[model samples]
Target chain A: MLLESTEQVSRWHERRAAFAELDPSMRAEALQRQANSIRRDIVRMISAAGQGHIGGDFSVTDVLTVLFNVVLDVDPHEPRRDGRDIFILSKGHCAAALYATLASAGFFSPNELATFMKPLSDLNGHPANTKVPGVETSTGPLGHGLPVAVGAALGSRIKGAPARVVVVTGDGEMQEGSNWEALMSASHLGLDNLTLFIDRNRLQQGARTEETNALDPLDEKLAAFGLEVRVIDGHDFRQLEAAFGPSTTGKPVAIVANTIKGKGVSFIEDRVEWHHKVPSTEQVEMALEELAQ
Target chain B: MSTLLDTAPVDNRVAFAEELIELASHDDRIVAVCNDSVGSSNLVAFRERFPDRLVNVGIAEQNMVGVGAGLAAVGLIPFVCAAGPFLTGRALEQIKADVAYSQQNVILCGMSPGMAYGELGPTHHSVEDFSWLRALPGLDIVVPADAAQTRIALRQAVAEPRPTYIRIGRHKVPPVSPETNVLERGRFALAREGSDATIIAAGTEVSKALEAAEILAGRGVSVRVLNAVYIAPLDQQAIAAAARDTRAIVTAEEANVAGGLGAAVAAVVAELPKSQRVPMRILGLRDFAPTGSTDFLLDHFGLNAAGLVRAVEEVLNGD
Candidate 1:
């Protein structure tokens, strides 16, 4: 089963409540600790499974951490409970990071993490909403989540629900025309309840996004699509927390989180090959040791 | 024009818009999403009734479908309406992943399907929708025969909020067996019951099949007509019965002969014992059409009543 018991759920709620009450510095320290642990989980999971997008996973770990622990109002026990803030991992190649985060949040047992990408395991290479509790929708296709986010936000407004819809997409995924289409729709509908958090790790599967598709004027492009853009150092927990605030611009907020792929480990940082490159046993041990800090 | 064509054919889109508005009035969960196709999709009345409920995504089919799936995920019943070719062709992967694979409660409204846009050319023709959509598993693909069946399909969608795709007909068609009081779920409506030969058809082609049965009767060929409503969970029971009971089986649709209703019947019949099997004729477009009006194109491709009767006679004569 995906979710833990009701007791574990209450513990999760209590932990998030406590984290929310923490001052900025202490909250960052706590989040940094959890993000590091999630990164360690990524290293161990990839090394054992021999299949994972380690670069994007590491790059997106902190965003997932901040959203689950402090931002998103989801009940791990009731993943489909109405009025809960919906979170979608559009950049779903980074399922390792999402699985680890959801596990930490008690959406599912950490034991299931051992079955990552194995035959007949629910933890496949990409997240499946039918099998996984925390996944709002089955999203692995690039440029899918944001459009759905727009619809969710619109539906919420139509029903007068106080739910917020947040989706995280890879910066390289921004090259997809559908994202621009969704951005235009969101802006046209004036959806303040929607937030698009982009994991700008500057790398896709084959090459750096700049050298490949060149999203150099990404800020202007987002602004052109009518989103109130906020560029942030994605590694900083405080900035991650700040970028997720309610949109005061009366429009959708685009959080362009500039990050380093394979972050926290010195060797893998910004290295393009680790997009799904399996880590060696020695490399995994060294990575975990560095994350132990 | 044949007396069969004399009946004032109602565009089933009228039934679509009326039923949607009727359903939305009672249940606020019903919201319509279109790709700047509000007027063409017959959603103007819906917009007028509840302006906020109509989501026009500005000429983007991919985003329109994705948004509809998202809306459904968020506990809203979204009727994602778009032109058939664009809805099924452009955002096909979204339809596959977001709606079919995810199994969201999204109702896809493929408006004016099956060569409804005649002069506008093959690019606008949704003749390939059936072949394209039937390949997806677990999607409730329904092609309403006429106005009443159209309403029935809509109500059924709301009752069972499964991943459904309803091909809303823009081609005018007379009601099928107005006397057959109730339509069964996933079962073909046997429009005319005869023992010699059977003609199974869907959408605008159903009425043509019925008329073909009439013409066949005049020609001393006792033909049965089966109105295929549900395409995906094809009434295999009724279909196999037709194959068993009749001398021959001929499948017709306003779609390509590939993966649509005919191919569906062929697959089912291919499972039967060789002795029980009947010779079949799959009638529809084999290739893309040259420029013409809806009637000219359908007739040119032998999608009319005469075509249906000829196919039945050929199968009966083993030609």
Candidate 2:
């Protein structure tokens, strides 16, 4: 049987402690308001840039919000702290959500969000670890993040540290053969400290993932590769927070977060053409209005 | 001719393995990663001593390289050992992406490189290792001439914090470098100095080039022989000096003539002032070697001492 640490038990206890400091009915309201603010920030940033992967940005917003707000053991002020949990965005095209989430968590100043993708800006189209304080590795190529995450997780394990490694990859990007190789090795090494979260938005560059090359039965595939599988609603903050709980088994965990492309926005949600389509001025106003409520 | 020599003939692979073991003993973080070829790579001793540190990925070259990158990511200095053909040919993309582009500090050990597996056919021969690897940036390619140079090169690679490829030959070679010679990157060794012509060679060709120099000296044709251990960052100073002083230059290696030592030397010589430039001849594998013994294959490919002398004479005559 896996034993839960005293520190972890106390952290679980602090969840209630934080709630006790708030009014009984205000706790849920506070979290909902914070989530809505993060979504609004994501919409505003992507709309101003006029060029971003708004689909994945919206789909993964709540997941990132929950991780930054509640789940992860990270110190935004000290991003390079040795004991901090590493969060790697393998689906790097979703820079808007990551930038907003990072800024909201104070990894960098919130004012820097205005410079995303400008000429000579440190915030390029994709997140670069050399430029961003909280980014762990530079990733845009598919199938690169899991291997690197495996390395960081293995490093934490070798050093006997309690830090966990979380990597988020796209559903379509799993077609690269290197991901399976990493999966097998991570499972064989029994890296229980590692967690892979698949952003199953179901849309790739050109077409729907099923119309391209299907990655359905993703849970079975990951389980076959020896990872303990957890299917969750990616946009649900409560589900994401629960899935981010400490692993009870001494094996790597794979959370297949089912999400819709362009989630939260009315017209673009679940639309295949919106994988990287930037919203126009009118669309941006509509999105901001929807998110403001 | 039959006088007794005190030293025994040693294969460079043994030297490579022994040096690696010594380095690992001092640094516990040094790990050996192989594609199920521990015996062929002479890593039996390493596996026996440190069983936990040896990661045998079992016949998957791609996975072997990726795992090496993973190990490097975690602060372990991994020496990925495998046959030359499989290591470079089978997993070229992995080498390019994971090791070179990712800038992972993993030592890629190509065992039995460059047609050393004679009669094993084209599939087994690694004649394209140099051409394939030289194209990739941020990787140091070192083909040691003999045991001493191999040891020095291995030690230097371990101490340096970068990606490197060490080509270890299966064929036996006579020790050329003096025991006092320290190996440094982009530094060439002048085995003998002459003014008539310069013979630039690496790997097994270095000894043959020296032998050819002795033959040319007998005929009063003074020749300069240079042993090029580091191929990528070619010693520009030494190569430039050879071009300036020598009447002509002859480059030889156990790889294709397209992008190997010959192409590298040609690139350097082409950039020099026309008046200072010398006539050149690149003697190496222009095509795949026919199935035969290693000795016959070398002779067939014009890689022996006699072939080197003729090429030097031909280049000297401007033919």
Candidate 3:
């Protein structure tokens, strides 16, 4: 029932190749279906484990889908290949979503999803780069990913490598001043190769981002920090694709991905209490059914 | 490793920068990152020679450390230089998560460590770096005794890439360690050998401990001195042997007595075979220092040669 390590690697490569070679017209639908399937996997994994941030996972699923299915140029066998585009999940609390995406995209076996946060699991609560493939850097603490992205971008530039770096952070996580510091550095270095996505789900752990700490005029604030800011509906494939393109402003790009927490299921979406709450058995069935539809 | 024949006192920061520049010149993967501490970290010449390689991330310590980790993630060996207080105190979480837990190939160069920032007071003093960094697993903490050790430590870090922190002291220190003995990881160098008493020291305090040993030798109290190179992976063999062979011991460091070279040696000594209850003394700054120079601060807190001699004598005679 379990594939060997080499078999698992090849399986992911085949899956990734299939999706990567899909027809241009069918790209959006394929990404949506993959995202929907990954969502179901996340719901099951967290429900079985009884511990996870399912709300943020639901909110940030689409961008991750587009990244793995479309934007990024990475290989499961050679995750750290020279001149490969790097992607990091700065809001690492939603690791279930990342694991699901990586599994579906063929980085590893989908069977590994059962081991999420289980005993001796490589899938830690936060994304650890050393343990996980396709994770460029370990990021769990707020404001960590942007600086790393800046550094990677600079490294690529200095080495004459055309590799690009893309990092996603939670809107609630942006209140950390370190992100601003990194923004300053990225702008100073003129890292056009770096792209930052702020999952603007508007909800933090306890309450709303505005109620806890206001990040109003988020786009303007990013612009002030010398980034090329773009606001888009986070779940829209077309908009995400447009915003995720190469930076024309010759500055670091920042996309405020306006989204609703717990986006897919009707009951969970826009609710504050579902930030990390596990659904009961009945709720799990309902959520999965809703995601399937 | 280059041989050191100069007996004149030298600042380890100078050697650190020179060694970094030399290493970076040959290896294009080697880069430097700082938080607007280029001047303070003595990286002016490095920045000049390799302008494109020195990444100045303004005055942000957390970002500086995270950037260092990121660069290392991309296969570039980064020597992240910053003032010791800010690098260790401000960006501790980054150091813990990014470098230590993740095991990034980062060489964190903590410049001007300990009371080297003397008159700036406790706000700028990094006396707690040992205790703070020692708690993190997989992060190697090295405190080189002099200029030669500083250069060797840098080369060793590059030779065997891992998450490491090296303390580059600002205080001027005379060379005490010779070039003959290999710089082994987690092993203390025998600075002076004797059988009557032992003094364990690191960083700027190694020279002071040697001076104290000479005075103790004149008083008919032969003293053994150990330069504690690796603070985290402590040389337990040397520490246990010293405690077993010597009548008394004194641990000195340019750090707090609470948790540093002294605390590390004590922890090792506590695990020794139960028969040897060696009387000991830990000489370091016990409280926040007053307005003074580095020498004044060391003498004020009883960390000078005379103070170390007195502490060793008391431990030897009291037992």
Candidate 4:
């Protein structure tokens, strides 16, 4: 009886270790399927709610997908895990994508996606940190995430911990002078552990970024501000994975992810009207079909 | 009155720095984010002690507040110190977005609030801070009356993790509360007690309200004084009780009349029971103050003891 019990314990331990050793490639593939499902769900939710930032949502979906799936060392069950990586969505209007991603990553019930903008729901028009389990900070206004990311990075460093801080911001949101101020401080402090990803959709609320306020020399600007800049196709998962890895330079990294607004759905791609425009029933069905494929 | 030996009066800003330094000594999470106002904020010692902790983000007020919020996001207790005018006016959007809406645990220390820099003109005066900041939700607005209150408020601010704005007054103020008096949020300090009328004040005007009460007492007018430390979460209970017991109420603040302490009191009094309702007179800047010395500006704006006494008398006569 003792020998039989010993054999059973060893078998359980081997299975546990094997599950823990799952490769990143396999994890990324699982996350990709989840991301596609999340995108489909976002379209349905926005369509049902009759209001949402669809363009930015579609643009940042893949970015959030990779972070929650591959890069971040976090457990949804322990959302506030002390040693876990900190992820702040600075451009809070893109909350539809974040909410979907968090839900898929098991931060909350996937059914909660149905309550995106319902009155009195924990999920509101914007992501509120106090209400949401996975949300690190409440953000709606632009140019806020970077600084908080820097602080989180600094705090981790203060405690002599290996946890990293990542903040995703919209390119249009960077026009606010606050982002640069944070950039300067992050560089000055040499916050190598922090990574900033800009969802460069090349469009703002009213017009194209170039027409509204040109950030043509964005890479140069970030470099001048002392960050090690890396330009990537935001929707490309492989490139995002490489860019988000541990930094070598003793300075903050800015991944200028080139993205198309209203990605995945062809009709609304690069359109300004879709910034916060909820799709009709027909459009939602079409979006779901496109994401499903 | 008999002459007493006058000691060098301590500035509340120094007290603010001292308390912050003390907190930082123990808590590694305590970080100071500033807009290049180390000397002005009296954080030179704080910077020297914790060089790594002091984040001087140049002269950009908007960025300073944003960075402070960011620091708070990572589980760091950030004390964002800067000139009141620049901190509030320059970065009003950041305060609204990152600090208030985001609900970051940031201690926004508004150095030298009110018309402290009188000769510097209207642009420098933080008269609109109370109104502008009070309008935002999930933020605590603290205008400390003296050095002791400044220390207590700063300590309490860190202990209670929330978005808080501390208006550190530049104008000299005499300590009104007892040494043992613990500063509590949304609680008014009874500086003096009487029955005929009540004087409500905050920041530098608290001491002036006390002086006004003494002057009114000599003139056969029984006056009560209440020090309003937390302006946003106004001590409604104390205010309602004062309005109920007294025949008249007078509110004094070194801020604008539109949305400052006076406006807050007026809103509460309007909702009070008709039997307990009393006549109220608000004393504050009605228009852009003219350029002059700090004392001259306070007198001109009717934020002095004489102004409070006059406002109380007007309320009494009207009632």
Could you tell me every candidate's TM-score relative to the true structure? 0.97, 0.86, 0.96, 0.93
> Under CAPRI classification, how is model 2 graded?
acceptable
**Residue B3 CA displacement from its true place in model 4, Å:** 9.8
Candidates 1 and 2, the one with greater DockQ: 1
Worst 10 contiguous positions by lDDT, candidate 2 chain B: B1-10
Q: What is the TM-score of chain A in candidate 1?
A: 0.97
Q: What is the C-alpha RMSD of each candidate to the true structure, in Å?
A: 1.8, 5.7, 2.5, 5.2
| Candidate 2 Cα outliers beyond 4 Å, as residue runs | A1-52, A67-86, A95-134, A159-163, B1-9
Docking quality of model 3: it rates as medium
Rate residue B30 of model 4 by lDDT: 91
The better-scoring model by TM-score among 2 and 3 is: 3
Q: What is candidate 2's lDDT per residue for A1-293, written digit by digit as tens?
A: 01223443444346535744675346545555666676677676767777888888878877776676666787655566766788888788988888777766666766777888877777778877657767766567677778767766765665567468888999998998878877877888788989999989888889989899999899999999999999998876667777987777888999999998887778989988888887888887888787775
Model 4 TM-score, all chains together:
0.93
* Candidate 4 per-residue C-alpha lDDT over B46-87 given as tens digits, one digit per residue, 9 for 90 to 100: 989999888888888887887788677767899999989999
- State the lDDT of candidate 2 residue by residue for B130-201, as single tens digits: 888999988889989889888888888778858888899888887777766897787888877999999999
Local error of candidate 3 at residue A89 (angstroms): 0.5
| Ten contiguous residues minimizing lDDT sum, candidate 3 chain A | A1-10
- lDDT per model vs. reference: 0.88, 0.81, 0.87, 0.83
Output the number of the lDDT-best candidate. Answer: 1
Candidates' chain A TM-scores: 0.97, 0.89, 0.94, 0.90
Better of 3 and 4 by lDDT: 3
Higher-DockQ candidate of 3 and 4: 3
Residue-level error in angstroms, candidate 3, position A241: 1.8
- Model 1, B1-319: lDDT tens per residue? 2453467889999999999999999999999999889989999999999898898898999999999988898899999999999999999999988898888999999999999999999999999988888889878888888888889888878877889999999988987756235666678887888999989999999889888988988989888888888887789998789889998999988899988899999999989999788889999988998899999999998999999988998899974
